[model samples]
Target chain A: MTDRLEAQFAFLNEADRLKSVLRATTLCDASRPENSGEHSWHLALYALVLADQAGPGVNIDRVIRMLLLHDLVEIDVGDVPIHSQNGTAHGSAETQAAEARAAERIFGLLPGDLRDDLRALWEEFEAAETPDAVFAKSLDRVQPVMQNLACGGGTWATYDVTFDQLESRVGVKIARGAPRLWDWVRCKVRPWFG
Target chain B: MTDRLEAQFAFLNEADRLKSVLRATTLCDASRPENSGEHSWHLALYALVLADQAGPGVNIDRVIRMLLLHDLVEIDVGDVPIHSQNGTAHGSAETQAAEARAAERIFGLLPGDLRDDLRALWEEFEAAETPDAVFAKSLDRVQPVMQNLACGGGTWATYDVTFDQLESRVGVKIARGAPRLWDWVRCKVRPWFG
Candidate 1:
């Protein structure tokens, strides 16, 4: 038991490797940038507090799980911002391959049941057909918007972003997942545009 | 506008510094391991999934918020493992002082309403009087146990922990926040003890 415990600790110790990879990939305020761990944590909280606001009857727990594990694959494939016009092309295959490797290495540290459960949750999130996935993606999109607003147009300024681009990035998810939040964003951005 | 944006970006960027401080303080499993970001994210998800199991009338949103922000102060005072023999010896004055500093630095970044809201949530969580705080703490305590069980006695083996120690650390919160979960733990751990 002690020897097995030691072996497990070695893997847990490398958990920071996930953080390191996240830090390398994500941008903090769209401009300044942040690590993946912070992004994951913040999104998890969003999934929790705002779950009720999700399209009715969404399973928030599953959404939270999805949010936490979603970017973890970035540990290998690296973060590819959904809004990156130029960077989006041809990245999915490589990213998918990287994520598969990351899921195996990271989730493998846990006992069998947990490994399977978490890995399945990660896969479910990627598929994004269920209520949980939709809500999780909504949280993911909203988090960056909140950061951008708080940071005074973080990515908007950095990318010379137009209202059209912002709308396109966030509109669909917000409309589908949390219309109230979408309304809030629309109201909030209108003043800036004017 | 640029000046305001830069200021906000600086605030968001400081999240890295906070992450570093939390990494230094909290244990990943039990024996002073894993980064703080992981702990925060894990607990948030735990709160989300277990919301249905919380004592009757518990506000799931508030509980989730508390779980997310409770440890942000670890950014300043660092993680004080409740199970540690040293925990009882630590004075509240040190923790309070650190919390004050952390609250100011971290929450000050957001615009007015958000800053106040998050800061208040953090303080409320620390006070632990509200139902949200109680359930939040329960989830916090339970997450490590789940992780340990998954990783085959994570901190229990590393620290040579006893059943008594585990109970002393987690008992009260479990009793108040989620009695059923406590019962489940007892059932699982009883065999290990034998």
Candidate 2:
């Protein structure tokens, strides 16, 4: 029991490091770059607030869980912004491999059952295979766009992101899980992109 | 549908303000004061990581949900630190009433059903009634202590907090829902307070 409790505390302490892991997207207020921890929280809220707009069969609860656990890998690999370097490394084989290794070491800090469960959830999110993961991924994309739009093309301006690039890189994934949300975001961001 | 979507977006955008609402507790690294948003997120992670330590019958999913919604009111009324002003205003009647009003106005921005659902969750967290709420409240108190411990008395030193005050103000509630966690935390934080 003592060992197990120590392991959990160690994992939680390591998780605290995530608060210092900055992302490419700044806060909408443009004060500073949002950390992965808060970004994950905001995305979970997005899952709850926008659950109605999700694709059919999506489990909002699971979507929320996925969102909460999704970017934890960023603690290890660092955030690979979707628009960074023309979006080449965002879903690159190298990045995915790094994130998988990160998931193992980080989640492995927990006891056996928890390590397996969280690793699976992180994998489900990486795969983006199920309805829950799809919806979670959609919000994952939707949030940065919303942030960028709110901050006057935050990362877009910094990265010199083009409309075509956004469409191919971010729009399709968001649309795949929540078409109406994509439509709403499209209308809001199109003017800036053009 | 458009109105509903707009309402959701408005509420979420307003929630963006929460990221700006700072709390008394600093980050573990002592970099800056943690915002209510990330603080809430860290608490949610604590709920997940420490579920085994919670009282029997605590539902972690509900605990996570409560943590996520619990601090949105800070966007309006601002964070009233538990140890602030010698812990007088933390749960003062004026603060409770103000938070109730804040909850109504903030959650009310959502469409009817979601507004009720989230508002009710927020109230449940505030009331700390059910097993889940009890567990959620426990994590709320636990995270700050952990942060303070990690940061060399982050809030305790800032507030000149004492051992007796911490036990009465924070320790009892944490013990109620997670006695083992409280035990571990007590061992860690006792020296700092002394």
Candidate 3:
């Protein structure tokens, strides 16, 4: 095979690792925690179905790409739930440090151009600044909440996630994506939370 | 919620069905068969890592989107393995008829505009005519072959798939997308087959 195909195959083979990286969120059936592979897959579909919810004029393609690449770092660092609460910002410094390294290593396995492009997509998902990013973030936060609600308060029951923590961590982003889903979920879920 | 978000949510909720739709190909480890969800996920990542192999000037985004939506119809119709020959084409006429109906029903859950757009993407994947479609088809063919090789001739051993059968069935599409990988696999896997 060609050199580029070899590099591509290597990267593709490495991606199988994501299937084994389990998350804290249980499946809607509560049979097992969903792996990063299926979560990212489900998130990409969520981006597709919910693109309109991401505010007017957002680029759905970019958001879909962002969702596809988002949890790849979890292949390296494992999933850190939104409620991990390390007494720090979005994630603990140690976790962020680990993910950044994981991103570099995993994405670097691709040839330079593809590697740069994918790494850029991962960064875009992390920055959550662009219209696409904001919308992607909205759906990202929404999935687990929907899963939790779907399965009679999935992981949240274990975490005992309070209304305030959920509001600050998830609702803030939902409000940007679709104020309606935000309002709807709050009414549905807050009663279950402490 | 607005009508669009409601439609989107209903569609998103329904996407969980994909996780249960089993495909014929096993995971790389051959421990169990793969689901459409994670297979789609792996294929999207394959599009990213193998974008360069699609030759110059292909739309990587379109290819990625196609792969993501490809098997969604399987959620309704269930997976049809490439080797499920009943003296017809890739799949039986009944299977194709069922899939078309399934596609319409599942995608119809989305708001009209998004539903039409996604159904178009799914058809593009099915047609595999455009440059993006060709590349997407190419990777789709490559994935199961790679998985079989990874797991020491996974399903091929079970079915006793021959070199000639694989050549006609899979290699035709494989040649279009990545010929080198195709040529390499022929030499490597022909020994496993009769």
List CA RMSD, all candidates: 7.7, 1.3, 2.5
lDDT of 2 by residue, B1-194 (tens): 88998899889888888888999988888899999988888888888778888877887888888999999999989999998898898989999999999998999999999999999999888898889998898899989998888888888887888899999999999999889888888987887755
A60-160: candidate 3 lDDT, tens digit per residue: 88888888888888877888877765314447778889989999999888888888988998888787788788888888888999888777887777767
Better of 1 and 2 by DockQ: 2
- Worst-scoring 10-residue span by lDDT in model 1 chain A: A23-32
Residues B4-58 of candidate 3: C-alpha lDDT, one tens digit per residue: 7777777777787787778888888777788888999999988867665777768
Candidate 2 chain B: 10-residue stretch with minimal lDDT: B185-194
Clashes of 1: 8
B94: Cα error in model 2, Å: 1.5
Candidate 1 runs further than 4 Å off: A1-11, A22-32, A85-91, A190-194, B1-23, B26-39, B42-67, B73-194
- Local distance difference test values of all predictions, in order: 0.64, 0.88, 0.81
The collision pairs in model 1 are A22-A36, A27-A33, A27-A34, A28-A33, A28-A34, B27-B33, B28-B33, B28-B34
What does candidate 1's lDDT look like per residue over A7-55, in tens digits?
3334444443445553322343344356676678867755644544677
Candidate achieving the largest TM-score: 2
**Each model's number of backbone clashes?**
8, 0, 0
Considering lDDT, where higher is better, how would the candidates rank from best to worst?
2, 3, 1
lDDT by residue for model 2 (A126-191), tens: 898898998899899999998888888899999998998898899999999999889888988899
TM-score of each: 0.60, 0.97, 0.91
